[model samples]
Target: MTLRLSVISASVLLALTTHSIAFADDSAFEVIEVTGHHEGSYSSVSTDSSTPQVDISGLLEQLPGAAVNGNGPLTGIAQYRGLYGDRVNTQVNGVTLASAGPNAMDTPLSYASLVNSERLEMTRGIAPVSAGTDTIGGSVKVIESQASFDEISGKVAAQYQDNGQRSHLGAKTNIANQDHALLVYGDLLKGSENTTSGSGNEIAPTTYDKNIFGGQYRFNLGDSGNESIAIGYQHLETTEAGTPALPMDIDFIRSDRVKLEGIHALSSWELNWHLAYSDAKHGMDNFSQRMKMPSMNARYNNADSASFDGAISVGKDTWLFGIDSQLSQHNSVISDPTMAMFNVDNFNDVQDDTYSAFAQWQQDINQWNWQLGARVKHYMTDAGEVSHSMAEMMPAIKMLMTQFNNADRTQSQTGVDLVLNGRYQVNSELSWIFGLARKQASASYQQRYLWVPMQSTGGLADGRTYVGQMDLELETAYQLELGADFSSDKLTISPRVFLHRIDDYIQGVPATDPAVKMAAMMMGDDNPMQFANVDAELFGMDLAAAYQLNDSWSLDMNASYVSGERRDIEDNLYRISPPKVILGVNYKSNNWLARVEGLGVSAQDKVSKTQFEQRTAGYGLMNISVAYDADSWMLKAGVNNLFDTEYEDHLAGYNRVMGGDLSPGERMPGTGMNAWLSGEYRF
Candidate 1:
């Protein structure tokens, strides 16, 4: 299968290359100047007619050094360089959305619906401190449609795909006068349990249905100010969604959110304020999506969060400052209807609060642009009384719980961040960029408060159980980056190299205590681990290039490579992405456009034995798309994974679902050939 796909891809590439026009000296894309003095590897996504209604992680994959690790259709976790999850900060309209599920079934990007957004941007390498607090990975920002007063506008779109029998419909409208405006949007998506692997075998428990709706109201303040209030709600229902890396299957996830924002302009400064609140409820079970075990167990978890932010900014070469705060609470419970006395409280009254203050200074000196920023943050967590039915059955466990309950259950920590960025233009067509930063992040609530072994370690899905360390110290990172951008009439290229060293990096390792291992064995548990701190280092390089072959054709390419290892021991880090490359050709005419691309990933042999990581083989995929535009309507059609070659992703989690050809510990298979069509009408 792999050989067949590679031959097909090579033939397509040869055909496209032979038909290309003569090379010409011209820019491949229009260059847009940034409004601020920020310096970094930044890219903006086009939200025009050609963009599809997919998750944020899917869109981010178009950029260099980015990948999406999927647990479900909507649960796409963004990975950049060699880090992911909480290490990266995602913001929608300058507000952060907290995950609702303990296993991260509802990721931060899950809240930002692509149907209602207008623009998206990503910052690569070391991000500025002003972007957000605790940003060791990078940042993703999304801007939603805003109320317009110039005229009334609306759009309706629909799409269908054959892989999972998936369907989507969305509509949005804006109504406004000279003094006030209102915008409303809604979307519906549904799919069946028919997702097929590259081998044409159906993957069970992969169906879902979801609905989203939101509205925003804006009122004109004076000449250059406005106040807006917005509300959003999302409901997701899953019949048998599988989490191959974790222990359970998701049954349902429901979330609701509200936000209020106001901007006021003064003589030489602008004041901005925002407030947000969100609530999420999730349920999971072992029998719903896979083979039923003797213990027909079910679990439910609920989480809620509230946040506030305020900032004041002056003109360029001035100062900007702000303060932000967030508070969250979590609770969980388990039940078994067949057994009368089978009940457990996994988590109870777990609360966390975070507050931070930041300031930034940007200035332009001669031919150089520079920015300096700092942030201070305080974090605290407390867990009320916790109990479980298993503890009661085991006297040794009961004694450990008694001691834990009597000890102090509250912890606090404070950390600081500093960042500096500079850019220098050597000539009109070349620029040099450099950045340095020191960042810190406190442990999560699950890492600091979990009393029993569980599978809630940031959704690693590694099929390992871990216990929390209450006295864990904060993790700190030192990072540096250097890059250059070269642009000419017919070519544009940007390349960057970065290095990161972390102190007291937190990770899960094998639990070696005799008594703990004996107790776990007695409870029918294996692969017991505990969270510990170790030093680590990572280095990587990313390159992106584009060339214009003529007025009707263009070529683009991107490549990324990264490596990570434990500094204190001779072992490799876990779940790091292997080297990858993407190449594409695009042809455009008066009213239509067509594109073809090939993507390839190299084999990953650097496995981490302590984490029980496995190696994966290499694979390549072929894709093609075409689109056409009329007076007020547009249509797009595409096919992905054209060869249906069977392969597994190095970053994918293990297969845990029963009643399948694949074993429990085997890597999950990638999706097979899929064809889709979409259309939109605007007024």
Candidate 2:
């Protein structure tokens, strides 16, 4: 019974007192229709591209039940519909952190750096307990665009890509008036070593490097901004990155983050607050960035982490109240730079904390427009008391670290979340929506403290090897959704259908402990795995559309379909993602713009023999882009796989780096035929 919370989220204080824009050519896909009392329908996607995304999961795969579980090419694990890693919840720029690589390869969308990210929002279905303290596999927001309440602006960009000869540059600056404002940004990206798979080979020399910089300070107490405060700072540095599907590689990762937000305007209630902090340090190795191992199998790992989250809110005239929090701590070790007596503690003194409280209500009732939210969350995890030196000559790893150090590694949990949403605006171009939810999660301190056998499952790169699960439970979800929207004046569409049903669903099994299969066959792996509690069920449908066949032509589309199963072992559910579609066509006026895209996917034979999975076949691709928007200069170009098709991306990951050209658990191919160029400037 311990809870520590800091809450805020009144839509991030109405998006920090509003007025934010910094999207230079966000490539349209616009579809908005609201009436008689509203607010809800999303998509802010546009990770500003000219193709040169070494990360940000390729712009979260163009949203719509999104997907990306690549694990190298600079990692990326974020799945919306079929839940992914720590059950997805990330907010960068608004801060919420933890991912110092426990095999996540620095996931959490790799701290939103796709060359100075600007927007990558989410919230289309079943998310809302005021958006997070864990949305139970939902909640993503990475926004950065502030400055200009009246004055100096900034932007500078650069890009180049020719399949792994990649590069990107970034800059941002803004200093304002009207009671203070400032924003500073920096970026850099590097590459080489992905020679465009799909038989153009070279899938494992694995190279990548990254950088990001940040700054923010905002203040206003009257004179609009409705009373506000903001302070922020962020920095990230990654070096020698390469995750050939895990087993080490990534010589470094560093992070530092901070945030504080505010809003106040009393006169009948209005207050908001937000706080965030993070520190991450990570290092990995398996022969100094890939290949060459002897000297007792050379390996190294170092980890350090910290996270503090916040929220505080109050609103009136539509009711809202909040309290939310997060706290994280981790430390990992494991070394052997040629044996300093080969140490390993891997994860010691770890902790995962959470706290929350929420209440929300919105109303309109004329054409209906309602929302209801409620939440109560708690989780406190613990660890510490572990040791190893190859477990004193391995007595089955010293009896599983003496039975996980005499057991009782705490885990306390409490959860209750609910949401009821509605829209029904049968006029002004149609609308109908519904959502009901109940979500929760607990278990992820790398799934209850790994005491031995490792692949550090958090990234589940699926090379397999796992351990940890000390009375783990609590992973609920029960949801429903239905949707609609149809506008006119040149068409518009939005659709949805959903289901969730989770219940305990933790997954990963096949370690019928016999001292964890004799210490995973003396640490060489004999197929050990564990992390149970299952039940599962997932259903989906998604769609988004646009038409407007005139006024410089337009057309857009997106599609998704999900299906996960394991309602008590009928199998199927483990890296699920298949069924996809995207289509585009555009033409803009004045200052030319052009686009043409097509993508299709489908052919994943419902695999997952308990993660012995492998099934992919089905692909299509095409792309083309053109832009020129000059006034202060802008130029863009693109040509991704225009006809160099060669598929195999069942969500990648499984090429355990050993040699070039992949093998040793194959399947990690997709990407070839590229062309990109970009330039931007604005002042």
Best by TM-score: 1
| Clash statistics: count for each candidate | 2, 5
Return the TM-score for candidate 1, rounded to 2 decimals: 0.91
| Cα-based TM-score, every candidate | 0.91, 0.34
lDDT of 2 by residue, 428-542 (tens): 9888988888888887887788878788878778887888797788888888999887666766667688999998888788988788788887667788888888888898777
Clashing pairs in 1: 26-489, 26-490
User: Against the hidden true structure, what lDDT does model 1 obtain?
Assistant: 0.71
Candidate 1: RMSD over Cα atoms? 4.3
Candidate 2: TM-score?
Answer: 0.34
Worst 10 residues of 1 by lDDT: 24-33
Candidate 1 — number of clashing residue pairs?
Answer: 2
Model 2 lowest lDDT segment of ten: 1-10
